[model samples]
Target: MSLTDVIEGTRQATAADPANAQVSFSVANTLVPGTATAVEVRVRDHRFAVDEPAPLGGTDTAANPVEYALAALGSCQVITYQFWAAKLGIPLEQVKVTVDGDLDLHGFFGFADTRPGFTDVRITVELAGPADAADYEKLKQQVDEHCPVLDLFRNPTPTSTTLAQLTG
Candidate 1:
């Protein structure tokens, strides 16, 4: 089918129920439920306080640093794909993301010349549903192109840090 046909079909499916099609919520959490006695998220931006988990290396159970990276990439892919699915009206039965990264302890601990973080990362996505191969490929391309995390990874932004003391 032509690109227009594919897009039109997806639209038809998504428009069936706009209300239940999706819900929006800002996701921020410190840790999994039951793992900690209390969770607190401190936003320096002064918006509001949210109950979030303590630092990863803290006494409380925390997801490893690598897991956090995987989570970010995986979440970005899933959300990006879902958004397109809803907009295109594609019947997305399932979307699975598996991210893997490799690093060396020597580099991480600062004994080596390599970077302290992940040297390489791989994000694999599996979509379940019925659609032509070309259509599926197009969907995958769009998701990859639009995924925020992927864009960030592909074209990294510079970061700067400053130290300050809080006065009481």
Candidate 2:
């Protein structure tokens, strides 16, 4: 089956039942002992490590969480561009996305009043296709409006945290 068919089928299903559009995703993370800042993360069947650099007191065994955040944004942008271009019939040949973010350590360390997370993020999308500039621009607009990760970065989401304790 084609991507368009899949997309259309999803649209139809969600339209038929709004519950079909409601979905949740989750990941589990555990701090690795004997490490300054290392986390084991599991998403479904996949597993990965997240660690900080030496400057942050970690052994630099893997990419940090912030780096993964940037990667997520970049990869999502690429996927959104491909999907939107196909749906819009823009004749896309290639899509590449670059993402960068600025962060301040003061907030994380509680040394000053600053945001601990990324203050700003920038994305650049490169496309190689026969489509005109206006068409590509339109495609970008559609992607900006539709991409889920972009929305997550652009807007604030309601979140909550709870602590659970276990005794051995």
Candidate 3:
């Protein structure tokens, strides 16, 4: 089965049952022992480490959380471009995304009033295909409107935190 077919099938199924369109994802993480800022993350069957660079007091074992966020945005943009191109019947031979984000450590350290997250992010999408510029522009518009990670970055999401105690 082609990706177009799969995309259309999913669209039809979701249209028939709106509940099918709503889904949730989850991941688990634990702080690595004897590390200042290293964590082990579990997503389904996959496992990876997340840590800051040496300058941030971590052992520089892996990409930091902010880097992961940028990666998520870039990867999501690529996926959205492919799916939108297929759904719109636009020929997409290749797609590449580049993401960059700016952060200020003063916020994390509480030394200043700056926000503790990315203040600005930039994304560049390189597309290669037979489609004309207009078609590509249309695809870009659709992707900008539909990409989940982009939405997460553009809009504020309500979040809550709870404290749990573990006893041995």
Candidate 4:
């Protein structure tokens, strides 16, 4: 529906579960040998494919995984801005954002000691709103502090993996 509906729904859900407001999301993926690298991912009722760049081995069919991560981060930042702006009664006209990352492929090819993921990422938000620069800066600070994906990238979250095989 609308963003207002999401905001109101979030408010009601938080009120209902004040103590533990946690939700779990899951996605399944499958891979098969082909000319190009590809993975079929199913999330909820949606299905999509992820592929690497031509140099990386794919035919540049779809966005690579790291690109998807950057996209997710950018999207989460926008959502944070919208949610907080609504909650704080700020007149947010429009939110535009750009996210970029630097990569050191040495780590991927097992060359140097560089990290495997984005070495650095920058997100620039161009806000079109009635609020002045100070208000915009304050809201951006709030987004940096409260955005879940930002936290996920900035800090460490313990994760466990389990594997099971299906017999045919």
Candidate 5:
């Protein structure tokens, strides 16, 4: 769709149901322990797999959990770039995001008090557009403020896990 279409859609949605501006998403994972490192991931009506690389222990069948996390961040950034560019009147012809995370082996192996999550992450946003640098900067600032995944990473969101028995 064109940027104008997206802008109009967003405007209509927000105007019709402001509450929808705030939303929630759900995801589920079921272990497929039959494989060395694979899990059935369910998000809405879609089903996929998440796995670890061979070096870490499992077959290099799918992206590992950490990689998925980084991908999530990158995906969210991509979404925000387009969404905000449309909203803020920035012209973006093309956009690409490259994300990387640094992790310490000791943290994952329980050898140290280091963080089990990414020690840090870097994301490079490459763009091809007619907008000037200042316009790009303005759009980026808006994206930084609006991106949900970016907010989740930059700020602390309290999360609790619950375990329950499932009977089939």
Candidate 6:
């Protein structure tokens, strides 16, 4: 009868059935040519080539995992900037960030490969806003301190991993 009633009806009709809920499973799979072949990594229902160029020979993406880490930081910086811009009522025309890091190819801990972890990272951001340089600089400082992801990365957190077996 009312707008709220009509909207609620539409929402209920479109919502998934709670009685027969669906569960999502995350899994990773990889296949290579042979013992001589390169490595491959597959995850989240997508496959990627570990050796040659993807699609051509395969999805030979950039450095393993490191690329993802860089992207994560860059994305967080952009999102944080946007959040502050909206809160301060600064109309932003564009927001951009460049994240770079260095690592030794050799694995640490005297492993098979002596790849070194990221030694350093640099992030550069560009934002267009009505706020003056002084205000923008202050906001940038605040964002660096308040951004959760940035803080987490800046100060490493201890973590543990466990493998669980599912039983039916």
Give the winner by lDDT.
Answer: 3
Where is the poorest 10-residue window by lDDT in model 3? 1-10
Cα deviation of 91, candidate 6, in Å: 3.2
Candidate 5 residues 53-113, lDDT tens each?
8888887777888889899999999988998888777889998999998999998899998
Query: What is residue 79's positional error in candidate 3, in angstroms?
Result: 0.4
**C-alpha lDDT of all candidate models, in order:** 0.69, 0.92, 0.95, 0.87, 0.87, 0.67
* Per-model C-alpha RMSD: 8.9, 1.0, 0.9, 2.0, 1.9, 8.9
Write candidate 1's Cα lDDT for 4-117 as tens digits: 565566667679866544645453335435554334444454332223245423443445546666788899899888777766767778899999988766776678788777
Model 3 segments more than 4 A misplaced: none
TM-score of each model, in listed order: 0.64, 0.96, 0.97, 0.89, 0.89, 0.59
What local lDDT does model 1 show for residue 87? 60
lDDT of 3 at 57: 95
**Residue 62 miss distance in model 3 (angstroms):** 0.6
Higher-ranked by lDDT: 4 or 6? 4
Question: Weakest 10 consecutive residues, lDDT, candidate 4?
Answer: 28-37
> Residue 166 CA error for candidate 2 (Å)?
3.1
The CA lDDT at 96 in model 4 is 83
Which residue pairs clash in candidate 5?
none
TM-score quality measure for candidate 4: 0.89
* Quality of model 3 by C-alpha lDDT: 0.95
- What is the Cα-based lDDT of residue 60 in candidate 2? 95
Instruction: Residues 47-114, candidate 6: write the lDDT tens digits.
Output: 66444344334355444456667887899888877776655555666889999988664554455565
